[model samples]
Target: MLLISTQNITVKLKYYFNNNGQHYFQRSIPRALQRFYGDKKIVRHKLPSIHSQMLLEMNRLAHHYDQHFKALKSGQGGTPSQIQEQAVALLASHGVLPGAANTPARVPEGMYEYPHLDYIEDYLRDKKQAGTMTKVDELAQLLLSKPMPILLSQATDVYFENHEHGTSEKFKKNTLKRWKNIYDVTGGDIALADVTREMARRYIKHRLTTVKTTTVERELKTIRAVINSVIKEKSLNLSNKFERLTIPKKGKDSVARKPFSQDEYRKLIAGCVSKADEIRVLILICCLTGVRPSEAAGLRREDVYLDDEYPHFDVVEYGGRTLKTKNSVRKVPLIPAAAKVLAQYLETHTDSVVFPRYCDGNEVLGDNVSGATNRYIASLGISKTLYSARHTVKTLLDQAGTPEYLAESIGGWGKPSISRGYGDGHSLARKYAALQKALTTVLVNESE
Candidate 1:
């Protein structure tokens, strides 16, 4: 029964605990505007109970109702068509296909009727009694015209059909997995129209209980892409509910991927050479050449060119791993130290892959390499991940006064504003010189 005290708003807040003891906010429309809102007057949404979040929801609703009331007052709110549209939109947004709303139970005993008509009807009835529904909204207009309804299950297939080129199988599978997760939460293979903003928010909330905020954020992003793809192909008027979401920051949300300090870099590299294991070779190559760990792990026997005047390795898409960007498919000049390490390793290894133990013919075992290297760094008392080596390379290159574009090329980072259609590219000798100078900061006595 407490009142919210934002400026110009004396909002009466009604809250109750859910089955899980979660709190939410309830609101009623101004009495005069109920008819314009399809005779609905009350609204409730699951809002966070944190004070700052509650205030944020307060501000958001204030602006929302301001626009809502203004629209109705100006004669721009519900009409017969707009009213039906709102019902269809809202029902779809809540995971109910509007076309199926009018389906009568036991229609002629076999007219291919939807079996759950009673449940849907009762759900509508409960909504009406709660004063959140208007006069019965007709869905015949949609059902008759668009007989072939789009469903969430069909969305990823449509999305990937047009967009899967140059992407890895792993990327496609992960995308499908994320969409399926969304579909499962919304009651399975539901109409695309049934996907709603409320459902998306709740999904994020639910997922945060199990995974990191960034992982949930990525899931939402992939879901959004699928929704947008469906909307484009079907020419549907569906709203994408997955955009511009707020994920409240919590501890352990994101570990800053920091570059290794010079002392740490020296110590880590020395440790790598001492072990001379597959992961250690990959780590040494990555630290010395500014390539990513995956890039090094996926390198093939043919990709490394140690006999050339300027020893370098190519980062082409290989072992079922696709290059992240077009620029990622370029070559990297190895420093003399990195070249020496690769040559020594190759003399004893006979596989077609440089990091043979970390790859199958299909793809590189990225997780295995990353976990092993990071754990190794920790064993030596360094707190950086394997990817930190890439960051360290960038830092050292800048310290060595390498040109920004050269640094970008070495790191395989793309710059959309610039074109790379010029002759060949930066010379290997030049790249070698830049990288050599950069490593000078990280130079230390090799482990005997």
Candidate 2:
């Protein structure tokens, strides 16, 4: 991997090797990054048998391989800008710009350029008979047609309006935030066509430097989705900038959101009892019921049914209230642990909303609760956050071997069941039973 410098170009000879009179090009992907390549620790490409040709081709492959390795390490996706730059720089080595010629050598730019009627007929017959005419037509339109000057901002505005019409405010907000990442990178004036593959590559590259690959992946996918919708709506003849791109997967050792351990759970519960705070009530309710933080914090007096048979809480979208998703609207059976504290907490305070400190009528500010309670947990020297309570429930249920559909139903997760267009879903008794079993496995053992 040593650098051999020359007048203007430096070529690494380590990548060029000959085996049994057969010349081959090879480069190591590096020890730390070998997992990303799977079994392919060393990359090998066959080179020309001739010495002069091998050296030139090797240099090009070296740059290509080096960039690829860098991308793998940094989670940067390849983009159009880099390719074009290479074309401008290594145009002499390529003989023609990359993708300019169909063949290894230059081909006629077009059949129409030399349109003799008989020649046209023969070419048409040959292309059609070979079943390659459609590909040619697509490639021709892709390369030759001048895309209309539609701004990226304009397309995004129309996409949210038309395509994702009924999406929630949170959805719209998140989508806009992700879209703004690219808009900020390239500016609002960049056209859909102008938002080239290189722009996406550079965007992922830049984002990866700061954020995780997973976040950038979602951002890129959102951009791709918007562009796709715009293309269909406007009938624009252009490729999606985010299409056919490969963003690296998260490394195996990446940190993930984990449930609180038994020790952590005891610490949190102790903190709740000692502090006697409303945010702790929100955390405990979420832990016991598997309701989202927003759902618990957003509960109205009408939503709580302390006298009910199962003593549950309803998550209806009445008034101007909103849940994360439609499935988030359900009734969760109140666990005894949550019920004991919450029942006492809600007795004297006659505010319509349960956690008024974190909520404003129907407009529930769960994030405020999350921030305050996360600080609370951190104060106790516990590493877990308030949201970990919800994750803890899921993990507990999983350990208790709760059925997938039952778990989904209890957590108000995902789509409606495929059974006869859905009835009232799992009854309160069944949902409570499954949840109680999970909590019993974790909480009952811990508390004892």
Whose lDDT is greatest here? 1
Checking candidate 1 for backbone clashes, the offending pairs are 92-194, 319-362, 319-363
Model 2: how far residue 178 lies from native, Å: 1.1
The clash numbers for all candidates, in the given order, read 3, 4
Candidate 2 segments whose C-alpha is farther than 4 A from its true place: 1-150, 163-172, 184-189, 232-235, 250-254, 316-327, 348-351, 361-366, 413-426, 441-448
Residue 65 of model 1, lDDT score: 50
Q: Positional deviation of 196 in candidate 1, in angstroms?
A: 1.2
Cα lDDT, all candidates: 0.70, 0.68
TM-score of each: 0.60, 0.57
Please provide, for model 2 over 1-448, each residue's C-alpha lDDT reduced to its tens digit, 9 standing for 90 to 100.
Answer: 3334578887667776667867777666678655433344676656777668877888887787677556555643233332222222222121222233333323377544323123324544676788776432333223322332456667777687775332445556667888888865685455577677778778877888888877877787888888898888889888887887776775542577788887788667766755656778877787788788778888988889888778898987754457778888777888776677789989858899998997778466655877887888898888877778778888888888987776777788866576623345446777778788888855653443
- lDDT for model 2: 0.68
TM-score of 1: 0.60
